[model samples]
Target: MTATTTADTPTAPQGHPRRWLILGVICLAQLTVVLDNTVLNVAIPSLTEELDATTSDIQWMINAYSLVQSGLLLTAGSAADRYGRKKMLAAGLALFGIGSLVAVLAGSTSQLIAARAGMGIGGALLLTTTLAVAMQIFTPDEHPKAIGIWSAVNALGFATGPLIGGFMIDHFWWGAIFLINLPVVALGLVAVVSLVPETKNPQGDRPDLLGALLSTIGMAALVFAIISGPEHGWASGRVLMTAAVAVAVLALFAYWESRAPYPMLDLHFFRNRKFTGAVTGAVLIAFGMSGALYLLTQHLQFVLGYGALEAGLRTAPLALVVVALNFSGLSAKWLARLGMPGSIALGMVLMSGGLVSIASLTEHGYGGTLLGLLLIGAGAAIANPAMAHAIMSAIPREKAGVGAGINGTLAEFGNGLGVAVLGAVLTSRFAALVPVAATSLPAALAAADSAEERERVTDAFSSGLETSQLMGAAAVLLGGLLAAALLRRAERAGDGRPGDGPAAGPDSPVGVSG
Candidate 1:
């Protein structure tokens, strides 16, 4: 296979003046999907009140979305390549809009959960295709910059979701948040039809249907075990059984994909050290960041006695820093100077250091916590784009959708893992310290009917947060070390290239040697 050069890769022709318009449509879809990840948090109180939902039911409202999205990502990507990317993107947008509408009218807990799952399905389709379409329109030389912009927009969506949801909830009904996606989706649909060109792989082999089914079931089960493990004892029969099924099924998925005539996910991609290292680094950063955020939000609200909105507002600085670093064109300079491995290692170092700094945060000293948030934000800004570049550059252009799907799945998996692992640790440590308390912090807080018990629970929770942050720090540092080692080997083997380097000329292969 020959490497594709900038001239040979699809760079939208001059006649296609609508490429940027198509980008706008993709960004809108991307933002909607990213925002939904956290946008519903602001509506949790309303959901409980209006839907008469139990605590567990309310939690499922959030978890159900992630479960479906992560489970179907790879399937969606392969379907796009086998079918048509533009067609899938349009279908996804329509599905997302319909889900939002259904969510607005949902009257029961189960209905709301189902609506969220629908949205997740749409999100999986939309996100997987966006990058694939972008790859097809942009030349290899321009792909990194386009991906950088997409990453920046994605980060901005995550950052703003809470703020937007909070503001809507303050003045309007909770359904107003769901209503917000409608106009955006409508506009996206129009722009997509008018501007985006339909593209699919004519020579693409049949999708691995059995592989997709096994992957979906296995991934869903694994996420289910992880999400529920902290609430239900890890040793519980259900948890253990679910985990066992996940492991067995995922092993089967690997075996099937390896033998499939056309695998949904090519197992051989992992054979490339650069691709594996990039994936490892991405998952680690996501795990640490997600876990830290989960703890910090609780600390700000429960320990510091801040309102939900106040906590969201306080985290605004971190988002602002992330946007500045990712959008300022400085990342290109950093990537050029540090290279992919160095950039990821440096980011992880900053993030780990920041988590360590804030591990012992107190009620009165938010300065240290803020500094830590900023450092983590900066690290993410540098790491995310470089990771995307590395993974995409290492894969064949025809597999862009598969690459995007794998990236999305890893991110969601990392998030679920982080929350489960760190949350379990926090619960265990808090339970150990407070012998009479409930096994979990939330349970303890709920069971605390008296002010005295509440105070004790609060203190225990704070201690748990400290311990969890420390653990998160250590885990991320280990990831950084692993990334450095793997990347160094790639460099020695002459496969590692600076993130901003020009694409191999038209005659070269898509990726470097294994």
Candidate 2:
């Protein structure tokens, strides 16, 4: 039971050729998960009309999926390595398909939430194991290219979610969005069973059930607390209590991981500065972009007076840039020339610049917004692949799933927290800037009470968005500097004595800082 590739397993150069097919299936499944992340937002109106969903009920629809997926990602990834990547992939696809069908048939808000959580579990397994599977099938030389394609598909899926969801909502029932996933799931299941090779960590110890429990609970609580903070009042006892519990549980999780024979996440991997930097950069990137985009969408709809479809269409320029850069083979070349740390810093700088430009935009400055979005998208395109490549390159092949899971967990947490924190910033700013004479902006604006009040609300909201953008820009710039510094220090420290310093081994990719 050595942790070596099985004789029957297919590799990139092996006579049994199905590596690309495996990648395709993995991406297809991944796309389904990614789409679910944002697609439901567009369907909320239809869902409320059909199911009589209250505001809180609709919020849970989104939160349930995010919470469960983030919570279970680490456990799912580790389990995939211990159990078998192919087996987990197949099981995950099945679960996802079943969950989608259940969602389609859900008669109540609670039922939909449950189904969404089920889908989250499936998504966690699928996403966590996919990178491991890709790493297993492709040779070292081909791994980066494989990752580039994967990243492109991932970004595209998320980008197009609203568009696809809107189209379905307009033409069909809200259930159609969930129904669309079935075909992809079916194809993925077939590919996983027939084309994909089984890979597992034969040396992996027994599953860390207790560690998994703590990790899941901690992550779920932390995400919930973050999402609810703005709504419940940041200083409210409920928020404080939940936040404290999250901290306590996570602290316990870290301690358990240090001692567990088979930890759900390997704590030592953080010793690699490149891996650590990559993870931290991913979080910050998600933090800045997710929060900024949330506010931008509101700006487009409320400030610009665009319809849902129109706003989504206007965002297409950003999505196009992301897709183009990721797939055009440019990112790999950038990585080769700039190195991981430098590339990440470059991307962050560009995004920060874009955010600043966006902050300067006026109500009539459509051109400025598009220009800013394009720059932001370009930066994201460059950063995402490089970070994924860095994480894969830094880790031992055997721990690929665990590494992937950690990457995903951090990304999810960052996205949710970003939205919460940034939303709070926007609300606070709006409240402060509003004229003291005006009562409620939403209510006043909706009623068309007075042109003066309308103008004041619009101006104040615009100011709030600008402030949020500035905050996001600063965060991204800070993240870039930190990543650059960490990488440089790690490289200077060298591999050193085993476990004594960061592990930037000889096998680590050239141009990738320690």
Q: For each candidate, what TM-score against the reference?
A: 0.88, 0.87
The 0-to-1 C-alpha lDDT of every candidate, in the order given, reads 0.75, 0.74
Global fold similarity of model 1 (TM-score): 0.88
Indicate which candidate wins on TM-score. Answer: 1
Steric collisions counted per model: 5, 0
- Per-residue lDDT of 1-514 in model 1, one digit per residue for the tens? 2122343556432222455566777988899888887677656656655676544565567667766787788788888876778888999999999999999998789988899988988988998999878776665656656777778777788767777877787778888889999999998898877667766665556766787679777877876776567667779988999999999999999998898888888888787788888888878877787777767766776678666577667766767877787667777678878988898889889889889877865455888888888887787777788888887777766666777888888777676667666766776667766635564455667788888888887788788899888888887888777876787788788764322232222212222110
Error of 1 at 464 (Å): 2.5
lDDT of 2 by residue, 1-514 (tens): 2233333333333212568877888888788888888778666556666887644465568767766887788788878877788888888889989999999998889999999989988988988888778876776666667788888887777668777876787778888899999998988887778777777765655667788778778876776676566556779998899999999999999999999887877778788786677777878887787777767766776788765566667777777888788678888788778877788889889989888888886455788888888888888777788778776666665666777887788777676666666766776667677764332344436655678977987888788899888888888888777876776666576632232111122111111110
- As for model 1, its CA RMSD to the true structure in angstroms is 4.7
What's the C-alpha lDDT at position 123 in model 1?
85
**Model 1: runs farther than 4 Å from truth?**
1-21, 44-59, 430-446, 496-514
Model 1 CA lDDT for position 238: 87
